[model samples]
Target: MKAAVVQEDKTVKVAEKAVPKLQPNEILLKTVSVGLNPTDWKHVKNFSRPGDIVGCDFVGKVVEIGSEVPVGEIKEGEVRWGFTRGGVDGERGGFAEYVAVDWDLSSVVPSNVTPQEASSIPIPFLTSVQALYIHLGVPEPPEKVSGEPWILIWSGFTAVGRYAIQLAKLSGFKVATTASEKNWAKLKEYGADVVFDYKDPDVVKKLKEATGDKIEYGFDCISEKGSVQLSQQAFRPEGGRLILLLPTPSESELPRPDVKTSTTLAYMMLGTPIQWGKITLPAQPEDRACFVRWTKITTELFAKGAIKPLDVHVVGDLDKIQEALDMLQSGKHSTKLVLNVS
Candidate 1:
């Protein structure tokens, strides 16, 4: 097998590696396509150990099932896609010819979805699920709240924000989101009721006034570059919940003292503790349960064409992984970058 392994110099190189042996509850996947995310590059630059594999989102075909896997739960030849905590393990990350994934963490890909499209969904889409239902307390789809409450999604053009907007709308919330002027129309198409330019100095005032100062919940997809402050300020004076995709800023950095803040990590959906440097996040079984339940629902929605994937740009195969990572690091492309690994 060949995998993108981190070097001591903090660069990723495709190197030969042995195939991973599966655990009792895991499945062996022959990698098909994988997605690139900021986490992949950040891990390389900040946290990953030398020789660790360096990717997260993947779509693959099940080649073998573990003995403890329930009968008929997952079968060989089924297309499955999910995310893993990449750059932590030398043998378990997604940017490899073969990957061993827990059966519970991976979902069956809808017949209508291409492997490239499915690859882009796991990390960002699941993050949106956790932020909306688990943290922000937005009612999940098929369970709409009355009165159509407004929820602002900071950075609507981001992969997480795109899914958050759609999911919030499906739950009968009126969605307000911020993006560049170029992305306003597309964000609206994704179910944003109002789109504001994030670059505008008065964006927070505009959003607060547009929602009648009733924006009670927010999902900040980009937690840096003043996004968190802006998102907190957009909330009503009474304040509400705000979900951050990254580590929460210091209390002094947030403008609103009344706003409740919680940080969400999509990797926790694997139902395992994560240790990055001195930071340790405990396992949350409830988060994993939410992922398992909603993944099935979202898969059904994908099959019925009720949900859509972000735009994907397939860069190439395994050999192209480094180039794709560079593109993501440069922040030049809006489309999801995918690599065919089969």
Candidate 2:
């Protein structure tokens, strides 16, 4: 097998390697499309992490299954997609031609979508779904809009932010978002009731001013200066919830002291009954499975056309993985970038 290996000098290259051997509950996937994300480049820059394979979102056909996996998990061949653990030091990711993930980490690809489209949905969509519906304790009551509940999604054009807008709309919240002027129209098309340019000097104030300061839920997809600052302003006075995709550093000073804040790094735990305060750090695999189930449900919603994958920039094949990463790193690609892994 040929894999994209992150070498000791912190560079990526194609190299020959043996395919991964699966464990009892693991299934082998023949990669068809792999999605590139920020973490793919972040990992390579932060560490001279050798032999690392870094692509998480994958759409692939099942080629092999471990003997111990349930009969339901395997088919002679089944198209499936999901995110593998792409933590800097975690398991080999889905970048190469094959990936072996626990059955819980994989879901059958939605039949109505093409592999490239399906590949763009899982990682960011799952993360957004987990962040909003789970970590923030938003009511999951069937969509009943008593009036628009002002919910702000900072950076609403990124993959996660795009899904955040759609999911909130599906759940009956009126969405307000911050994005570049170029993406504001697209954000409105995704059901954002109001959109603000992040570049505006008073972007956060503009968002609050437009919504009459009634924002109750905030999902910060961007963890940098813009998102953090804007979300702090957008959250309501009391009972307001803020969820950050990046873990809040222990030493970090929070701008909003009145609002309850939690980080969503343990993405799988979102939207479950488990309280955020009770969760143990360095999550167990079973704990992670909660997120897996969350993703499956979201994928089903997407297939039924309840939620949708946002604009996908398909940049050809696995050989172009580095190019995809460079696009994301350069902050040039507005929509999700998917690579057909043929």
Candidate 3:
């Protein structure tokens, strides 16, 4: 197999490596499409363990299944989309020609979606699912739970933000979100109650005014310094919930007690719980159940179009992995980037 490995020089190089064997609960996916995220490079520069395989979001055909995998849940040659953890990605990653997938993290791609489209779902969709369902207590999809408890999603056009907006809407929560004016119309079409320009000089003030402090929950997909502060403002001063996809303040910058905040690690989709700066936390039985339920629910939601696949900036070959990574880091693409591995 050939995978993109992160070298000590911080360069990504495609190198040949042995194929990985599956554990009793894993499956082998021969990569058909790979989604490149900004994290692909961020993980390389920051969280990297040298020589680590460097990507995670993928869609492929199942070539092998573990003994413990439930019969009929998935089959050889069936197409599936999934994501895996970083840092030690050699045995399992979308950047390679093949990856060992935890069966729980893999889901069948609906017939209506192409492999390239499915490849763009796992990281963003699971990140949104975990943030909304697992942490913030948002109602599950298919049950329309609407009312005064509105939600705020920062960076509405981001891959995760895009899914977060749709999922929140599907769950029946009214939403207020921020993005560029160019994206405002589509965000609204995707179900946001209101869209404000994130670059506005009064962006936070605008969000505060638009939602009337009634924004009781928020998912800060951006989590850059300003993003946290703004997301904090959107939630009611009286109290609310917030989920971040990036590193938050050093306990010192924590928010008001009335307002609860937590960060999500999407790799948890594989049934493991991970804490930043520290690795190797054991999977919690309850969390494993949470992730499994998330997979099943979202699989249905996606197939029915309750959750739409993201628009993608498609890169046509694995040979251009570095080119795709550079494009992601350039921050110009408003869509997810998928590498056609075949």
Runs off by more than 4 Å, candidate 3: 146-148, 251-257, 273-282
Per-candidate total of colliding backbone pairs: 0, 3, 0
Candidate that would win on TM-score:
1
Q: Rank the candidates by lDDT, best first.
A: 1, 3, 2
Per-residue lDDT tens digits of candidate 1, residues 270-294?
8889896897889999999998897
How well does candidate 1 score on lDDT at residue 339?
96
In model 3, what are the clashing residue pairs, if there are any?
A: none
Question: What's the distance in Å from true for residue 92, model 3?
Answer: 3.2
Question: What lDDT, from 0 to 1, does candidate 3 have?
Answer: 0.81
- Count backbone overlaps in model 1: 0
Ranking by TM-score: 1, 3, 2
Best by lDDT: 1
Better of 1 and 2 by lDDT: 1
lDDT of 2: 0.74
Candidate 1 segments exceeding 4 Å error: none
